[model samples]
Target: MGRTSDAGEKILAAGRSLFEARGYSALGVAEICKAAGVPKGSFYYFYASKEALALAVVDEHWADQRREWTRILSGVGKDGGDAGGAQPLDRLRKLFEETEAGQHAVQQGCGTVLGCLFGNLSLEMSNQTEAVRARLQEIFDAQVEMVAAVIGEARERGDVTVNDSREAARSVVAQLEGQVMFAKLYNNTGRLSPLWGNCLALLGARAA
Candidate 1:
């Protein structure tokens, strides 16, 4: 029982890594199982098809990322305590900073920026799979709402002047994805440096 569950997890981790590094269309189930160090039968045992595995990978990644995003954007500590009293805009800035740092770390590990898995798959596979397309839409919608909540708070506190918080938040999320795409294209994490400034502008913050 223990080994059975472990095999599924290994396949998931391998799929996520390969999908992020190579995009989805370029990979095959045999290749994924090889990377997972499991037999091809093990793949069939856990996933009905590659698309099903893709959905699993996306869900697992989002579950982890949503936790991190909540902790940072909501200013809640991992211990369920206050997270240093960061203001809304400041928490937003930290999100960008952490993004840059994360890409940099991935570059150092793999010698190239892998961009974002969700964004990469959205471009590469959204047209090919309706399931993946709908899932990606749902993910981005949640992200926009999270950022909009922050923007709404900032507006109430006079920290920003945005009229439509949701629209501004969509712009901010779009900007983040665009900048991450540029970072991957240029093979330079530095391309992400302007995200905070661009976000401030989107929010109509006085500092911007």
Candidate 2:
């Protein structure tokens, strides 16, 4: 990448890290600029305001998470074949296990829990700005849709006993977000394990 592009990316990376480690309202543009190793003036060149930079970070984070969710739920698209033949429940389990492991890795590397970016941003920005809140809601709605897709598959295949796929999907989202909140609170990835059974039971899915 060119120098200009590199500078923008640096600011974004630093912003994501800092904002994730600290709440959005708790950090400042000068701090982000310092973290990115860019001049404060250069920060303005890339982002018109700190809120703009925060939203950009949100977009980047969502892109990465959306890709992972698609892979986990739908499998990679290739010649009309799934990457794995695991059923919906199995896929859900894989998502849980992988999320735990990924968060653990983040904790080790960054010394922070770095839980759900959407959850973090929503709690901090929900009443702060309609634009950011709406974007966050859009991102979260996509996640709900992805989870709903899995539950729908489970229903069609008779893999689960849930009657309301939408409600069940919301329960799954709430449970996972709560788990992430606790994990972030305690800085322990293992906090996610006990809920594995709770989620499976909530969905009425077969055991892993």
Candidate 3:
């Protein structure tokens, strides 16, 4: 395959920012072009259509998010070493703390609670397009897998009592997205704590 063009990366980056700032329906092909500083022809050269680009953005954004997830939840320390030596519950707390910190940054920078990208797209386009909806479901499933892996590690160490790590992971992701949606509606990050608290209780991941 040919090397990825610089224009492709720029367009995807711009699309992510704009699509996150506004929903899919609100942004058009022309607007994406302008933000990306690329011509109409250039966009089609990389992506077949706006919808196609949206899928690519989801893939790209999730790749970046997953790396962070691995770093925090997987217990990889700054020097790329295993700090998984920490209790699963402790690692879970640190991961959620990091997630909260990131949301706080987005809230400050965007001047509003911009909820999870996957959640936003899931709500907006899940019923609109089968392919997009399928892609999103896959992303959510991958999220569950990631969380479940962490939970399994914790479980093996006797830190988490849950026998069904997959189910528990699903609940955690659902609650997270639900809290994010609430934050968006209330325009406050304060709602996250109680929701998170409930998850900690349910998963028995609370600190002593």
- Highest TM-score model number: 1
Structural similarity to truth (TM-score) of each candidate: 0.94, 0.90, 0.88
lDDT of 2 by residue, 46-81 (tens): 899998998998999899988887787765433446
Poorest 10 consecutive residues by lDDT, candidate 1: 1-10
Which residue pairs overlap in candidate 1's backbone? none
- The candidate scoring highest on lDDT is 1
| Model 1 TM-score, 2 decimals | 0.94
| Displacement of the residue 62 alpha carbon in candidate 2, Å | 0.6
lDDT per residue (tens digit) for residues 154-174 in model 3: 788777677899999999888
Using lDDT, rank the candidates from best to worst: 1, 2, 3
lDDT of 1 at 36: 91
RMSD of each candidate? Answer: 2.3, 2.9, 3.2
